[model samples]
Target: MKKLLIAVAALAAFAAAPHSASAGPCGLPNQTTLWIDFADGSVPHWEMFAKPGVIGAAANFIYPPRLRAAGAKTVYFDLNFRNRIGTPSDPEDAATVVDRAHRLFDYAAASMDCPTPWIALNELFGAGTATPWSATNAQYRANVLAFVRTLAARGGRPFLLVNSKPYTGGEAGDWWREVGKVADIVREVYFPAPSIHKQGAVLGSRSMRQGLRRAAADFLAIGIPPSRLGIMLGFQTTPRTGGREGLQPANAWFRVAKLTALASKQVSGELGLATVWSWGWGAWSDGERDPDKAAAACVWLWARDTSLCDGPKAAGPGFNTSLTEAQITLPRSVQCMVGAQRIGQYDLARLTAMTRDRDVAYSALFARAAESERVRISSERILAAERNVILLRFGGSTSAYRGALARAGASEQVGRGVLADELRRAEIKRTFQVPQPSGTEIAAYYATYSAALARSVEATPAAPWLGGAKRGVALASIAPPQVFKLPTGRRTAVRWFDGIYRVRPLGAPKVLGSIPLAQASGPISIALKQFARTNAFQSWTITQQKAALRRARCARDELPHVAEVELASYLPFLAID
Candidate 1:
């Protein structure tokens, strides 16, 4: 009988081994998407937009080549259609204005290319505010569809953006209903706090959810599938405010997460693309700005965690929740002496490069670094000087001729002075020597390094998964046919045995009769024993036996005999099946 039991165990072990040996599940793929607007009436600081890592946590960018150079894979060009809208001053001029609008649309369509399979149609003029809300509704819809058709002609999906607040009495619902027919996906930009006065309003609040639901219902009503809708989660930072204002202190980060999760859940059960309005806005002064602060915030909010709501709880209800712990602690780290010095040196070098003549070697060095790194020279004064140099060397009607020449003449002197100052401030310079590690130590180090790198890349900004040196068994996939039978004419269900033995089959099952085991008196111990053991009963340790017996004694009335059967027979089944 023992030999027969061993054979049964061996069969189970073989069945389970294949499943247990499988590799870990693949980590979440990058789903985060970002959009920035650079096609307004005036171009923003183009140099700033060009900086490396300046794209923040955005996976996509929406600007011209100048702005898209910041490493974003997708660029959505803002077709500033509002500029073309007008009432002809004379009756004859009306046709000319209309003709001009058509030409502009054709020109823009020809000029741009969608970087990815999906290209967004930025409806800059669709909001009701631009044209009279009632009179322009049909016109707005037609205009947007024209652009979308053009995009489709070039083999790209159309993305539409709409204001969150009611536009000319038409809220998101109305806009969605009107444009839903043409757009492949609809994105709504929600600003919880329209003004500072409205701060602390529940953004992803119960009301917000209701509003979204209403908008969604309208879309559904208009035959727009829920799968095609996305919301652009963001907070507005005005020049008056310091850090991101309108963020609920308690729920700032949580709100962002909740909304992201909610939108993802609502849209397609997938976190659709999101963009933080403008990464470099807020209190960015040329000299005092820390670009990484904004970038870190962007990363923290968007790609840090897959689910926003799954993260740590906010401090309290109705409390501001957007400000993350990282954001709170940022003020302290923002002033890092060494880091700040490096940034300042980089900025100074950029300034010097821009001011110097383009023909000079030093100018080339600075321009190369700035262009390569995408660092924006924030100071208009510096940009002006650089322009002057470009004009002087290149000649023609250029912006800043004299300043570039003056900086070029003094480039060597300034470069030397800056280099000397930096070297003098270096506090510690040392070379360390150590004996080579043994093979075992070397193998362990490599393993540790690989694990750390994997975790770092996989870690979400929202809630990072941490690891340590302690040995702990990872819960792998649960085996199939989790139910089992014993020799005592009884059946039992198997489940993970931590401190408690959680039955896999929650209720009565057809095949397996209940076991007579009692609840575990204390933590139930389990481990992978020798593969040679035929019957798992032989591999069951004394502790496991004792715990099984204790749990059997306390088996509930509903499952009276669930503990008596020897669970050891099922040990091989514990291997992920």
Candidate 2:
């Protein structure tokens, strides 16, 4: 933590702060606000909170049965007064959102005896690189201030949150201080540390909280008070029913809850007001059909008991052994005070080093010697991906960069970051080689096309998984099932055959677990053989396995040999009976 440029005097107080565990959940108080990401979902299912907590709705136009229920508490409505990524210059449209948010707040307050009623705004922070409403960071900050002032003029509680880097779009004003005036609290949500995961050193499910802690230090250094900031516990990796997705450790929910509590402590000085982003997204994009329930239950764990979320004091000796070099950026705690914030020219170099160092750590778990050099080049690639993401957000852009991202496997966060970094450097180098006009053209090409290229690299299933048998080989070749290695962590995989999946300990024959076709989603293939005649069935799957069993009735000739299976995710294996 070498740098002290951001705020020297104020941060000096943090020098002696001990890293002891908190006695309980950071005591964030009534600040826990629930959320309904979109208005189009089912009747806001507040039951999942299972206990008393805030329920936030992004576009809850009308009051509902739950709000009227006895003992119902706080319900926040996130404002969508205007198109967040649409035209940036229109102050009127932005004003409309402020006005509407106020109205929504008033209606809820008036309709029920709710204890706390507030309005929040998020996601207007556009996707990709642009700021809210597709405006520059400065413009976005001003717009937010404008909205805040509007709400303050009439006066109830109004808050603002964005899912971007700390202080990204809001620094145009006094940033921390000015916005703090009108906002109930100014907030930026930090979700999964895909960056940490990309580093591969954060380790186990518990370490994901490391990103939140780092981001918290950054936020504090920049002047956002602990009382005002919040972190939304989000999933960087989507959950699926089969393959690597299903292999997610069962303790995932516990890790998230504990991290949420740990992260809450990071920002809350004595004020004890760290907010955990909750409420839920409308539905899972992958289309898993878990009827009567929202397909993705990712955010469900945020409202749990905070006491259990704390990481225990080292029970004994080995607790601190595996700390990765990338975990702590600078040597001393004071240096990190300033080290956390990336200001001015220091932003690029500092961030690049940090990003590259982390990826190098991840390389140990995921990369081989032959690819080590290319892996080291991750810093440049990520910078390019960043630039490309920004350009892709430019007006008139469609999914033009999708093809390139596919080529680079950069659609994922880690890939997108590397490609964005690479494109940025290329633009700088090109500016010196050609005329300004030509360089500008080249820069555009790099930003747009290069980003897609990065996405393609990550999306490349084969890079993550060495080549394995694609389809069935003769059963005779394997009198007994042969041993094959399986990658671990998110990349770890297993193979599905017939109705059984063979999961092993990497290369060992010891079976770790078994996943039958009954629990799988999507499709499977099969074949049934009776006597001299054999019939191949492409559509046979778990859904039909039971009925087939009933008809066969287990008679000798009637019993048919089961054959074939479907495989997904990047599991390493050979085809088998």
The Cα error of candidate 2 at residue 32, in Å, is 10
Report the C-alpha lDDT of model 1 over 1-577, residue by residue, as the tens digit.
2332233233222211111111111111233433332322132233334433333221222444444454323334433434443211211222233344345434444333332233344444444353333433444444444444444333334456554332434343444443444344444544343232232222233233444455444445555564455444443344333323434442453345344333333333222323323322323354324332333233333433423221333223463334321121123212111111211234344434534432232322322222222222334433333333343333534433333334444342343332222221111000112233344553443333322211001111111011111111111111112222212223233222111122222233221112111211000111011111213322332323333322221101011111112211222111111
Best by lDDT: 2
Question: What Cα-based lDDT does every candidate model obtain?
Answer: 0.31, 0.33
Flag regions of model 1 displaced more than 4 Å: 1-71, 85-137, 165-178, 184-211, 239-243, 246-296, 299-577
Q: Write the residue-wise lDDT of candidate 2 on 207-277 in tens digits.
A: 43444545555556656556555555443233532111322232433233333433343333223444555
